[model samples]
Target: MIVDSLDIQKEIPLWALGDGEKVIQREFVFENFKQAFEFMTLSAEYAEEIDHHPDWSNSWNKVSVSLSTHSVGALTKLDIQLAKAMDAFASQVNSKN
Candidate 1:
């Protein structure tokens, strides 16, 4: 089921573009390309383990991510869970800087 924007905002302060949309978005910036790639590696592993992949792109030290459940045609619990996990991964990478 699609989640409410209010609940998602409360859960993830950094998430945006969730106003009746199928996706929730966030951008993570790292200290350098190496650090950014490391974040992607970690996030990719977790995403594969969970079987939920993000629609994302990387530009230099920045990673832009959008989470959505295409099968459901909306953002579901999986997107929220993955978003939280990605945020945690980004936090770890940021702290190592």
Candidate 2:
């Protein structure tokens, strides 16, 4: 089910909330490329496990992520969950550096 935009706003206020098709987006920066890759690797495993992938890209020490349920072309719990998981992974990766 598509999650309400208002709920998403309340849940992750730091993320950029776009209207309609733009969806939710956030950028994570690491101390180095190695740390960035670590975060992505962790997120990839989790995404695969849940069968929900993210639209994301990495360059050097930064990663940009956008979350939405592509099947329905809308925001959903899966996107929210993946966003939070990626956030946690970023935290863990940053802490390790």
Candidate 3:
């Protein structure tokens, strides 16, 4: 599913991946670096499980992740699924810290 701007806005912290409109993006904020890394680890496991990788960065308490089904040249079910998994991981990390 192509994530439209409207849907993106409604979901806090998640934005349609930019990069010339070819991916899905989300930025998650945590209490500190430790929490952020924890989320990253969880996301990594999930990504590996599905064989869907993401472009991501982490600085202090913030983690930015971008997902794209490069082979398809657009956002697909995989992107949305990863986004949701990331969201879940973020919530889990936040609650612990």
Clashing pairs in 2: none
lDDT of 2 by residue, 12-89 (tens): 776777657447999999999999999999999999999998888999999999887878878888888988888889
CA deviation > 4 Å runs, candidate 1: none
Q: What's the CA error at residue 27 for candidate 1, in Å?
A: 1.0
Top TM-score prediction, candidate number: 1
Reference-based lDDT, residue 29, model 1: 92
Worst 10 residues of 1 by lDDT: 14-23
Model 3 agreement with the true structure over 24-72: per-residue lDDT tens digits:
7778899989999999999999999999999999999999888888887
lDDT for model 2, on a 0 to 1 scale?
0.86
Show the colliding residue pairs in model 1: none
* lDDT (10s digit) by residue, model 1, range 1-97: 6787777889988999654677899989999999999999999999999999999999999999989899988888888899999999999999996
User: Given candidate 2, what's the lDDT at residue 59?
Assistant: 95
TM-score of predicted structure 2: 0.92
Q: Output the better candidate (1/2) by lDDT.
A: 1
> Model 3 segments beyond 4 Å from truth?
1-13
lDDT order, best first, reads 1, 2, 3
Judging by lDDT, tell me the better candidate of 1 and 3: 1
Score every model by TM-score: 0.94, 0.92, 0.82
